[model samples]
Target: MTVNLLYSITGLLIFFMGICGLMFHRSLVRQTLALNIAGAGIFLFLVAQAYKSDTVPPDPVPHGLVLTGIVIGASATALMLFLIGVHQSVSKSSNDEGERGS
Candidate 1:
């Protein structure tokens, strides 16, 4: 099989794994990780599609887009983690107050 096809297939498999993880897991952290995994798979697939062959030069536009997407994905993941931390803290505080009242 061609390297590009192999990469595309691998990317799709990874994306499928991520989707399964997201569906099966209940924890927000796990879901966030799954989302990131899915994003990575898309990036890989795009990279694979960007290539033409050894003779012809690869497309630069897709590469640039992938790079930009990676940055956005990282920022989004960080934001999600931060929100999770905030939620956990809020719930913990509320639970502690409830226990004290009881």
Candidate 2:
């Protein structure tokens, strides 16, 4: 009934969905998206918990943490994509070389 409860429930759902996606999907892109979804859910839960009441100010610590988390998540995703690109390029080149040799 409460806003906090609703946020918590939503966050849990998103987090679980992400986990399921990660477990079931074979594609690298999908797995990366799942990780981002899980991170967002964690941020949502933290922010929701930091809320005291309508009149009281929310805690700043959670906000700071969430920002840090976002940065880290972005960096990780970028790195993963870069690695995937490098791997694909290497594989392609190797395949091409093999074809030329034969």
Candidate 3:
């Protein structure tokens, strides 16, 4: 089998793992991490496909796209974390206020 094929297969497995993690975990952070892992798998798969056996180096187009994807994913993850933190803080404060009023 070709190296690209192997990489694609591995990427698929990792992607599935991330999906399972998201489905099974109750915590928001865990779900975000799972999404990140899935994103990584997709990047790896794309890079693998762009790799040419005849060429010493891989295509630049896929690399650029993967890099952009990584940056976007990073921003998205930060926003998700921030949102989760805000939600948790608000929920805690509200519960505390309710208890005090009771």
By summed lDDT, the worst window of 10 consecutive residues in model 2 runs over 8-17
Off by over 4 Å in 1: none
On a 0 to 1 TM-score scale, where does candidate 3 land against the true structure? 0.92
Pick out the ten consecutive residues of candidate 1 with the lowest summed lDDT.
8-17
Q: Which candidate achieves the best lDDT against the true structure?
A: 1
Q: Write the per-residue lDDT of candidate 3 for residues 1-74, one digit (tens) a residue.
A: 99899998898888888899999999999999999999988888888988888757778899899999999999
Candidate 2 Cα lDDT to native: 0.93
Q: What's the TM-score of each model vs. the native? A: 0.94, 0.95, 0.92
List the global CA lDDT of all models.
0.96, 0.93, 0.92
Q: Cα lDDT of model 3 overall? A: 0.92
lDDT per residue for candidate 1 within 1-102, as digits (tens), equals 899999999999999999999999999999999999998999999999999999999999999999999999999999999999999999999999999999
Q: Give the TM-score of candidate 2.
A: 0.95
**Order of candidates by TM-score, top first?**
2, 1, 3
| Root-mean-square deviation of every model | 0.9, 0.9, 1.3
- Model 1 lDDT, full chain set: 0.96
